[model samples]
Target: MRDIMGMMGKVKEMQAKMEKMQEEIAALEVEGKSGGGLVTVVMTGKGELKSVKIDPALFKDDDVEILEDLLVAAHKDAKDKVEAVAAEKTKAMTAGLPIPPGFKLPF
Candidate 1:
């Protein structure tokens, strides 16, 4: 009974920490670039698209397909960065927890 209660307390604490982490992530902004910096994407840590930029030279070609590809690449870069940051933060948050080695958090 005591162990169960203690586990419940830990779960509540983890929930609170996750909430705080989400807020922190939402406030962060990350930038990703592709095509040698010709195309750039800005996104929040929560993966929300904020803005996009394209170099004037890229527009000269007026190649819609190429532009689409670059945009996709840039978005992927930003998303990868967001995931990396989230993983790092989660690791820090759960540093001292007793979770099993192969267990994954629902976050």
Candidate 2:
């Protein structure tokens, strides 16, 4: 049962590390831009939208649809960045662990 006990200890340690990582991720902010920086979005690592910025010049344009599209693109960019950051941090946190390759944590 020693092996099992050791494994359990490792699991507990990993859990703590994961919790800390989650908090770190929640505190991170990433910025994304679109339409040659005319539209920008800020999002937390958890993919929550934090804020949006639009160039004043875009207001001079009459096509609202284009502005809408740019906003969507910018939000998507921010979301992608957030995912990238999460992946990076997770990789760091999992380094040297016994987890099988391609296995995801936190179920």
Best candidate, TM-score:
2
RMSD for all candidates, in order, please: 1.9, 1.7
| Cα lDDT tens digits for candidate 1, 19-46 | 9998898888999999999899999987
Worst 10 residues of 2 by lDDT: 98-107
Clashing pairs in 1: none
* Top-lDDT structure, candidate number: 1
**Model 1 misplaced regions, further than 4 Å:** 100-104
Per-candidate TM equals: 0.85, 0.89
Residue 71 displacement (Å), model 1: 0.5
Write candidate 2's Cα lDDT for 9-91 as tens digits. 99899899889989998888999999999999999887888899999998886889999999999999998887788888899
- True lDDT of residue 9, candidate 1: 96
